[model samples]
Target: KEFTYLIFPLLCFFYDKNTRRKEKNKRHCFLSVPRWVSLSLSMCLSQTLNRSKMNHIPIPITCQNDTEMSSRDIDYTVNALEVERILNYHFKNKRLVEDALTHSSYTDSVSYERLEFLGDSALGLVLSIYLFLTYPNLDPGQLSLLRASNISTEKLARVAIRHGLYRFVRHNASTALDDKVREFAEAVSQEDDPLIHGGTVKAPKILADIVESLAAAIYVDVDFDLQRLWVIFRGLLEPIVTLEDLQQQPQPVTMLFELCQKNGKQVDIKHWKNGSKYIASVYVDGNFIASGSSEQKEIAKLNVAKLSLHKLSDSRPTKMEGLENTGELDGKSEIEGAKQKLHELCRKKKWPKPSYNIKDEGPSHEKKFECSVQIVTADSMLSMTGDEKSRVKDAENSAASLMIHLLQESDYL
Candidate 1:
């Protein structure tokens, strides 16, 4: 009888277990959790994935509300089709390109500043290398002058505008692009037909900024290889970059003989002509020793030659100890090793130079007293002359010191 009772309970327990499972499964079916969740998750995933497939080319600023029919939309400067064409030509990495076209003014979420920084550096390196290899005989100063002029913001902007960059740039919804940039660009484009050019010009700075941003965009895209950059650069600089023309670019030192060895064209540098009537002058970086201007191209060329000679004269250094010998004044190392040596010698002779009046000048723990000693020692130059034993050598050293000072001031060093 007991066995029968236990079997009955066991049977009941098995029935209960099956009942609970059925109820749980029934709940699952009613909620449709598996089907619904899967669908939502998949849709979200697809949008994320599709972003990669679509190139970042901008939609036309004019097409913001494209009912497909109105040319009256002047709300934004750049158009979608123009952006698409430019990006399609230059960018391979769709994702990278999108990031580049996105102006900070367009949205608060992302920016291209980092990409801009990177692109600017890359362009500079590439252009410098091109100049180096192309003008193998050119001196360092000449190469740098060419590179700087070529890679300048204004030049880049002009290129961008020619390639339809203005079509992609979006201004604040409220403010149209500055009128100056528009006017200058129009004027340049329509040089042959001033009435058609509308005499509109864009601000040089604005145009350039947009161009740099575009370069950064192209850099992010995989399609823009070194060859592509070179091609673009060559086309843009074609007017000025011929072998013969490069010779006319300034040489702060004598490079005429070496220039002659390059591809033979009459070594002439003429003022570069764009649609604008602006003058181009050469300087070794920013230090200007000469200026030249003329209506005739050869006249302008002669002026550059004279300027190069002037540059040579201005730098006529009596103390041209090739960088290896500038000692403490070498290049950018401003540390005063000689001064410290002098101070130690003075200390040994019981003539410890006084400490510096100011303190904490650099990265070292070099005390204010050490700097003061240097200053005081410099002031005590007269006292050292009095010692008769060292009088003759002292005068000679003083004369040498005076010569060094004179050389520094003369510019003909």
Candidate 2:
């Protein structure tokens, strides 16, 4: 009798389980349980089957959503299709597109969190490859800066706004987000300078994420085809910053450091907190050049650098009279003139002689030499390269002349 009662309970348990499974399958709802819960249930069922000497059957968990789409979901699908059109590529799995556009705040079936993670890495790789091939002469540091400027939040957000990608993002953020989007759109429309390398504008991160997630979605849809992904996105990321652009107006901090190093001045950046704002001061050769304050230390530093640059420009002498007065340019060849001026400046500053590195290229009969002059200041090393010349001495002289001209322009001489 007791055994019969045990069998009855087991039958009831199986019948309830079967009923629930049928209902779930009919509704087409995914069964998402915690990992711990699933493991605990599996172990308990295995133990029970072992005790009864019966074969253990594994339970199948469905990860797909089989349920009917709500009105909102249908709208999301339509919007996603429009996004696909904007992207100029179709997804074999449409769910990937939907997931990419859905933000965590939406509380939908799934968000773009996973895809965003994947997209971040993919975007970095694509940009790295693009910059590396496009700028063959750029060093690793220059390549990094170029990549960072392109993939920055402001730049990516600008991309999203330009391509209408932000319209398809399924987010439930506050009105502030909408306001920010509108403001950003307006800012972009009125922007005379589109480059975000100066860090003057504030961009919403979600807009950037949308761009990245979509990139990831396309990558996955194409089965991780990086070349195809670049082809599609290269146009979307228009006005690609080139090496010339970076050199024309390098980052303020970089410009300041280079100027200080070339002028044999030491640059020191000091930071402090003033209530809620952060303050940064730039010191050149023990003198306080300029100070700036902002909520962010980086911005503050940039501002200080800009101010210092202005100060240096205003204080610079207009003529090369100092070089003439040094008695280094008396009846000498142009090459000797350049070398003597550089040596005199180094001696005045009590610094070591500048180093010259020369390289010869081409055949023996048509050989060309390239020279680079490296000046070691107290705090930094400033290097400048000159054009190729037929003679090594000419190349070195060209480098030295270039250095002197630069120093004069920056008011160092």
Candidate 3:
């Protein structure tokens, strides 16, 4: 009877009302069950019920139409429409606009990747043609540099921020991205120059991709007409880098190398990677001049070279009028004497020992050592780099001598 009672509940839970009713009717015709059987059935039914509840699976929620969308999706759609208004050109296929702004993180649907690729090629071609026509006399090298500056990632990102295109980018990335975009926008706002590259600030790549994808979308919508695409986008890429700008601000490495060569000196660049970042050190005539760190190896090298060039310019002799000729002071004895004097001065002043950073450049047969020295005193700190030396000790001595001369001239000795 107990087992029968337990089984009854199990049957009720498993079967629908009609099925349970039919089964109950059929059970009534059977002989009465024992109480133990009823109890056992009830226990089994309860266990089954608990197990079912524990194992319940939830149905995924999906939106079939705009009415079913959450407030966030609605806002996203509205912003997409506003983008068209901002551009003042409606996308014939509205999906293209959405595709341009849709980052890979946003949805599994089409993303900006394809469009970005297309836009990259289109942008390069357009810039090449524009530059070729604008500067007929400019060589291929100059034209290439000019085009690169005008349509670079930094330049496009700047354009996106200036025109408020980033706000429309549909990305599902973390709030960190929002913060980065905000920071980049603020940085651009503070910048005075309109045509910016990566020199002053680093621009986010996503912002640049959005601009390129949009350009590609425009090209596709206009039946792959390059002229039509240019007509729409030429003004958007304002303050194009001209030949004059390139001449005024040649690449840092180029400028530095040229300056060194003109003065009958050699420039060397050495770099190493630290995790994901790169550290670059510049040596002018075998002397450690400056160092820079960046996420990119090329950028780091450029920065180090630029700093070295600036230091060289600042240290150039202003008036060679009354100073002792110090003609070709590259001998071993002269360097040793200068190093001894620098050490004595530091000891007399009770200053900490001066430190030197040295680097070697060139082949084994023609190795050159560059050294940088920093001397910190009670009143001030002095840093100087010496001309390159054939030996490490000589480089150190040369650096010490340069610092001593600079200190005496500055009246700090």
Tens digits of per-residue lDDT for model 3, 23-134: 6763552335554454455444544544455474331211133345566655566776887776666765566787889999988457899999999999999888877888
Which regions of candidate 1 are displaced past 4 Å?
1-81, 87-92, 173-176, 190-203, 223-413
The regions of model 3 sitting more than 4 angstroms off are 1-77, 270-281, 291-298, 310-413
How well does candidate 3 score on lDDT at residue 96?
74
| Cα lDDT, model 3, residue 316 | 66
- Misplaced by over 4 Å in model 2 are 1-68, 270-281, 286-413
TM-score of every model versus the real structure: 0.38, 0.54, 0.55
Give the clash count for model 3.
Answer: 23
TM-score of 1: 0.38
Candidates ranked, most accurate by TM-score first: 3, 2, 1
lDDT of 2 by residue, 1-413 (tens): 34434443544365346577765552332134444444444445444544344344442221223254567666667887788788888776677888888888889568888888989899999999999888898899999888877887778988998888877777888988889888667646644346555332457778888889989888876656799999987777888877766654467689788877787889999999999899999888899888998776766777787677766754666333344446443443345668667867876875545655566779979989888765644444455667799976688788888777656554565
Give the better candidate number (1 or 2) by TM-score. Answer: 2
Indicate the worst ten consecutive residues by lDDT in candidate 2.
57-66
